[model samples]
Every structure is written in C-alpha cells, then in structure tokens.
Target: METLPKEQLLNSLEHLVDGHLQQAIRHFQNMTAHDLLQPAYNGGWSIAQCLDHLNSYGHYYLPKIQQGIAKNIHLPPKDTFKSSWLGAYFIKMMDPETGKKKYKAFKGHIPAPDLDAYAVVAEFIQQQENLLIYLKEARSTDLNAIRIPISIARFITLKLGDVFQFVIAHNERHIRQAMRNVTDINKRILH
Candidate 1:
C-alpha cells in the first residue's frame, strides 16, 4: 500500500481514533459487570480482557510517541512520510483485514482475569484520547525520523508514523475481538 500524505494520514487516523472511542464508550455503556467479565468461550478473553490488552499497548506506545514528538518539536513538518520497509511490514501485519493471525501477548502486557470492566473500559477510552493528541502533535515533526522502540525489544525501533499506524491497526483488531466476544456472549444467552 502507498504511504499517505502527512495531512491525509493524520486526518484518517484522527477519524479512526475518535470513532473507536465513541463506539467503545457506547458499547460498554449498557454492559453489566457480569457481561463485561464473561469470556467469549471457554478459556478465551472477555471483552474487558481484550480491551485491557489494548490498554497495555497504549500505555507503552503513547508515552514513547509523545516523547518523540516533544523532543523533535523544533523540526519542521514534512509533506510526506515514507515508512521504513520493516515498519510498513509490521503495520500490515497488524491490520485486521490481513486475516486473523494469532500473536502471543508479551507477558507484561497480558490482562489479568479479574480486571474490573468499568475501569478497563474507562482506561481504554482515555488511551484513545491520548492517541488522538499524539497524532496531532506528530504533524509538526518528520514522522520518518522520529523513532519509537517496540515493546517486544527495546533495541528495535520503528518510525513514529509507523508506530501510530501499528497502534491504530492493533486497536482495531482487538476492538473487533472484544465486540465479537460480546456478540458471542449475547448469542449464548439467547440460546
């Protein structure tokens, strides 16, 4: 896929971030504690757990992106961002449309079974807001030059633009997972 122009990329990402925020808030508004905590199937994560997983990622990436933008605030904005080959590959892998590819969660990022649903949902909403801010902040920097270390290996890094793309795509993947969990639970209840 071709890289988007900087303004276009940021605009698209903002729309995605805001849409997810609204959808998640609306979805969780009606969910009871029991509904939120119940797993989709035996041994599977609940909607809350899936969101908590996304929250864990947000916790890591949001700060790194923020710091990169702040440190590079003096740099002039660029018209375009050329994602690194590896960065592009990672973003593609994270895209939900690529089909489901099971990836093991990093040990530290895994959600505990006993998570409070309301709190987890609230945190996810907050993280999405933060992501929106970072996307706006990123417009002023050369996205390709600002590097953020991957959570898997601090030694490995990707450009800020790629990191934003990965994070947004990853969120979409899990939001769909969480929504599916909710649908499954509702179906089982109906049956």
Candidate 2:
C-alpha cells in the first residue's frame, strides 16, 4: 500500500463516512415501510436486507476496531500508514468503483430475509455513526501498527488503516446495491 499523509488520509475517510451517513439519511427519509422492504426482483434482497448485511459487518468490525484502538492508545500517532499487502488486496476487491467481481457473504454475515425495514435502517445509521467515532480515535494512533483480525479468520489480521478502508468501501458497495434495489422497485411499481 502506498503511503499517504495522515491528515489527507483522515480527511478522505471522514468524507467517506459522512457521505454514507448523508446518503443513508436521504435515501430512507421519505421511504415507506413497504418500499423499504420491497425486493428489486424475484428472490432478490430488499433495501432492508442490504442494510442488515452491512449491520452484520459492523457487528464484527466495530468491536475489533475499538479493542485495537484501546490496546494501542499509548502508541504515538504516525504521519503515514503503510497498509498490509493482503489488506490492500481485500480493499481493492471490495471497492465498488473498481467494478471488480462480486463476492458471496460468509455464512455468518448473511442477514435473515425477514427483517424490520425501519430497524435495519436505524441500525445501519448507528453503525455508520460509530464508525465515525472510530475514525476519530484512529487519528491519534498508528493505523499501520494496529492489526485487526479478519471476520473470516481470527488468526489473520490487517492493519487498522486497511480495515477501515475495507469497511468503508464495503459499506459503499452495499449502500449502492440498496439504492439500486429501491430504484428497481419504484420502476416496477410505476408500470
């Protein structure tokens, strides 16, 4: 992973987090419960399902991040983060902008099809807010020095910076999926 100035990196991350928060709020603001729960097509996930999937990820990653930050609280902050090669690969793979291959959710991360749409949206927004807090905590630590375990394998870990990047990118991907689902539902309803 290439080195980036700390301030620049933090700013970028803040932008990403804030964008998620804003987009989520706007997307769900006026949506009816029916719209939120409606699937795009037969056997497809609803907006609630997309949010639930992201929430499942948050349930795993947020705690790991918090623990890592607490453990590394005494360490001095660094000016740049050197991302792990593996972590970088994961982030690249998950980034929606890359138009890379889609991945199936691990069994544990898959959300139930039946979920309350409002509750799912609320949980997702809360998780995003929590992520913003973690990002702030990260500003005072060496992002590269702190290693967080992957949800898939507790034995393997990635640098904190890479984990954050991966989480943000993943969120963006799913959020976009949820938006697309909403659009498709609306189109079908109109016709």
TM-scores for all predictions? 0.94, 0.94
lDDT of 2 by residue, 43-99 (tens): 667888888999998999999999999999999999998777898888889999884
Per-candidate count of clashing residue pairs (backbone under 3 Å): 0, 0
Clashes of 2: 0
Give the runs in model 2 whose Cα sits over 4 Å from its true position. none
The segments of candidate 1 whose C-alpha lies over 4 angstroms from its true place after superposition are none
Q: Clashing pairs in model 2?
A: none
Q: Kindly list the per-residue Cα lDDT of model 1 for residues 1-191, writing each as its tens digit.
A: 46679999899999999989988888975699898898877567888998899999988898899899999988888889888888889988889998368888889888998988999999999999888888988888998789999999899999899999899999998888888877888788899
